[model samples]
Target: MDFGSSLGPIRPRRSGRLGDTVVTYLVDRIVSADYPVDSALPTEPELCEEFGVSRTVVRESIKLLEEKGLVRATPGRGTRVLEPPGWNLLDPIVLEAQIRHDRELKILDDLISVRAALESDMAAATARTIKAPQQQELADQLDVLADLLDDAGAYAAEDVAFHELIMVASGNRLGHAIIHSIHSKARLSSRYNGTPTRADQEQSMAEHRQIEALIRAGDADGVAVLMRTHIVGSWNRRRPEVHRSLTALPTVE
Candidate 1:
């Protein structure tokens, strides 16, 4: 790798920590295939010189990369980039890098599938145990969604809020945390959000209404199926045509 040209010096402006900035830089390079799997990374001295950081910062950044399963540093062999399968995809920084570099949309597709699975179950649980107050909450949220139909950006934000309400109603903290972490990062990718037409927003709102109705009626199975279908179908509609061959979740009947 051309450390001087391709990878520029780190700026003086501090973000969180110097180590974090360096980690982000290296993670982007590794995930983007600038440093391919099985290839050794630049030496510590080279990295230190390139980023203009001290040896301590570089070493700590390397340790952070190892913790994320991005690279392995052997005493005699230097650091070697690891395969994607070994990566901690749940880590926010690593996941963001992967999503940013995902040209074929495979990572986004898989992200939707995982989201569908977890959120569907959460929806079902909410439906089964939701009280009258919780049902009213969802109904009010649906109203808010309907009102925002004209503003796609605001509607998109509320769309996430509506789903989060359901997840909270389900009382599944772990599930909520996992989805929140991944979805928060995934939303930063343009491919993940896509460009929603007015018709698309209307369709999504309609699905939200149906989901609310099912939850109100305590129809767990129906809500689960609809939630899964809604998520995967939304992704299908927005996904680029060229990469449609990638596997997607099947909608439950």
Candidate 2:
């Protein structure tokens, strides 16, 4: 009862109603696989058999994929997976296409935005009542940031823990909820890429310390400022970098 992916480079003419057929099969497969970015496409025969169509039908089907930048055919090399902009990852179809293709998930962008929103709210809540131990914990994390910052993966992990602590300091049920929605793609990405430069980590640690100081002073606005700076700063750092693989990133811890 499963329909094949009609979304990508299915051959036209041989396959009737080019767009619908291509979209159906293509969308189904991508959705099933979660539309990962930069992943490889299935063999032509696979699409043919799956779609209950001929090779020409499958060939035309993939054409649509090329238009979306979701796939390409190398003639003898068959098809390679691709997921570039305009794939509408925010759209369910593109998301599935990227995931299906095994493209690197656009994790950093989403995760950082979530952190900005969650941490900012957490900082505001903490300003109302930050406990003595919690304040010290924040300070300790800042110091730790200064120390083991040579390890980017560890630094990212600690960064997440630091932000999560702010949520805990808020002393509200919403804290846990925020953590659940907030993701750790940044940390996971760091781990995948191994460690970055010590200088990078040091700068990050310094930023955390500044935020901790603001939180300790019960300056919600100041904490908010620092949190925004950290989030935006991290985004700016990674914005220039490119990633490989589009899906199945380590779940945010």
Candidate 3:
């Protein structure tokens, strides 16, 4: 393995969780795609050395990694990265970093564009394949958003749920992965953007209702358009206003 890129520091979190150190470093390498798909993974002993953790800790770390569909371990072959199918792109932790820490988003150009595309495709795929019961699940999420206008955390949670339910209902693996992958981003963006005014709240809820309806009706194209518009328009509309408010000086003439 190449070590040209900085390995930086690997400290076990104070939480004293058994595998935190190994987990953290492995996460970085995996997300960085240093552990290419289908490639054999470093031995648990190797990770133990790099992380200075016990063998048991490394075992636990590998277990979690495998659970996330990142790797497969055989008796003799050792652990290896799974092909594209094994990866759960929609994993919340993964999406959180992608959305919040993505430096490219500083300009809000192409990064936002990637998010927009993800939403569009996700909604469309959900609309195409979501079944009756799943549509009901999506509707319940809409009800939550409608009733709870003040609880930002609750609202955000439901928002992620809505997308997850829709993605599952749509019955598309990749679409499910996309929504899962960006699930945290959708929530974080909502939280940072915070509770909107009554007017904005109504408009947002109505938009969600519209998407839900389209999915129930199996209108893939329409749901796709509505979801994309809502996501892009949100960042476009709010971020600028936020920037101006933060940067502007208050003056009394």
Candidate 4:
């Protein structure tokens, strides 16, 4: 509850709102388990003093945390940290923190699993509904991706674009938004190694070409199966790197 030392120095942000700064500080502590679940958080006065912020800013930060399910503030017992299941992983701040914690937990494997499931469905749906320019766009993306096979950074960007285009073309706006959010967080995390080897790029390109062919042929079932296979295969190829990251992380007590 007393996170004074663990919370580190409270330097004011040069541009952002003080409340948001306080929120980031609290969210980081909560996710890192510096303020363990069910433990009482420092009082408003204590937080105010610690962050050198006003009661209003501290109060706003705690409110935001509550909205994200990171804590529950009781009238008399004060605020208490909640367990991971209690938190809203869809919340961007929480998602970022979750990915950070994932380096140790291998939570990205679970995320990839979910992504595979969603993308398979998205691919099938898009294949069913894809139109002229979008279909053409998907076809052209493969060529662009192939050309960038030697450029890891460029290939990664195109890889993201290729997948995002499918999701958007699926006409499932909500699904696209969700996948976009997932990729955004995952891309920022160290767990996602965006730089691929030449072989990896070639493999990805081949799978994508199959995906394009399936979509163009209107093979929904084939696209679904291939998409799932592609996702799992890609992750399997990088399993060693992922395993290394997991093993090297210091175990959180």
Candidate 5:
């Protein structure tokens, strides 16, 4: 309700503009259901006074929220928050908000499924076309993973890099973008859970090693199978209570 201290006077910044800060605050509130669907946002005058900004900044922020399908503005009726289905989940801002605060864990499940499908094809493509230098790059990442077995946080970071390299090398720019987006957002959430045990880390490393070997051998089928297995396996190891079969993942043509 109070945006005074929260969305205070926007200082001069090169990166996050004044409008962006307000947009982020409003998106967070909407995603958190603090502004439930059909609920009216604070009036323009109220927001201007609360954030110590002119009507221009407040109006721009509200416009942005509307563009992201988060709200509907009417002349007589104030801006009304919309339902989740109306939101643009693929939009980076909205996705980050969901990842940072969604408690239902549904977003995490969707992320895993998407990653599994895309990485399977990426792995296949990488295996078929990867050059020696890229292969070495992947090998180097594996070495880093092995060395960081004792450090979960560092290991997880390198692990993402390892896969990111493959996605890049696969020559699928769009796929890489989507996967990277998911990774960047997940890293900020509880969903990016890393291996917690020495044994678990060892298993993850083994899977990466196998995938690397398949790529070196140019075994596309093997690469696809192992990549999906590794992805799903990692998820299971991290959250044993949650099990979702990856068998339904379509094979890369």
Candidate 6:
């Protein structure tokens, strides 16, 4: 195979470090299945030539790929692309690449399910523990969402803020951190944040108001149910129609 053509043009350098560029290009190839599972990556010298980077940079890039579980390096066998199950999906680079190549929308579906599960639990926690001031803050965020209903872009941004505030109020720092990392990267995908109509935004705002009411009333169970419903429902409404039949997305209990 013509590895250079398969990998496409070397990306323009985005930083002073050449290794980062090489790593990103190689990651794109591996995740896109340009280099399929168990396939050997181009030899170091070949990579160096293709990427126009030094052998040292190529080696470091391979090292980074290995660290991300995208490849395995052996002294005599060279580096081979690993199976998808082995990949460090949480790594921003890997996740972004996977999202780009997720033709079936399976990853995005799974992403929404995971987000719903975590955010629902966090919402429950917040409802149980929120004091008057925190309740007021969440109500204020709902007001912000209402104001942005006419602006899809701004509404989407504040939509995220409203969810994050609930996560923060939950006091589940680990859940909050996990959601923060994945949600930010997931938003980069068009499929994940599908274009929302004004009607869609209005529905979402109404749901947000319901969530805030449940939280303010200290109804943890109600909040959890509504939070999960809101998230999964929003995704269903905006989910791209192109691949709807390919696979059914998992549901949250």
TM-score for each candidate, following the candidate numbering: 0.90, 0.53, 0.54, 0.89, 0.87, 0.90
Candidate lDDT values, in order:
0.87, 0.62, 0.65, 0.82, 0.82, 0.86
lDDT of 1 at 99: 82
**CA shift of 16, model 5, Å:** 6.9
Candidate 3 overall lDDT versus native = 0.65
Which scores higher on lDDT, 2 or 5?
5
Angstrom error at residue 21, model 6: 0.9
lDDT of 5 at 108: 75
- In candidate 5, which residue pairs clash? none
Q: lDDT tens digits, residues 184-253, model 4?
A: 8878754576446799988899999999999999999999999999998888776644454343332211
State the lDDT of candidate 1 residue by residue for 90-207, as single tens digits: 9998998888777677788899999999999999999999888878888999999999998988998999999999999999999999999999999977777889999999999999
Q: Write the per-residue lDDT of candidate 3 for residues 1-253, one digit (tens) a residue.
A: 3222344454555434747545655655665456777778789777777666778888888887787777888988888887655555456544443344333344244445766787778788877777777777787788889887776556656766776676666566775665455544554553336545666666778888898888788888998899889877766655533343343221111
What would the C-alpha RMSD of candidate 4 be, to one decimal place?
Answer: 3.6
C-alpha lDDT (0 to 100) for residue 40 of candidate 3: 81
Candidate 3 pairs with clashing backbones = 89-181, 90-180, 90-181, 130-169, 130-170
lDDT of 6 at 58: 84
Lowest summed-lDDT stretch of 10 residues in model 6? 244-253
Q: Is candidate 2 or candidate 5 better by TM-score?
A: 5
Alpha carbon deviation, residue 122, candidate 6 (Å)? 0.5
Ordering by TM-score: 1, 6, 4, 5, 3, 2
Residue-by-residue lDDT tens digits, candidate 6, 1-253: 3444655655656433778767877788888777999999989888877767778788888889999999999989889999899899899988888887787778888988999999999999999998888888888888888888889989999999999889999999999998899889889777888899999998999899999999988999999999999999999999887764554322111
Q: lDDT value for candidate 6? A: 0.86
TM for candidate 6 is 0.90
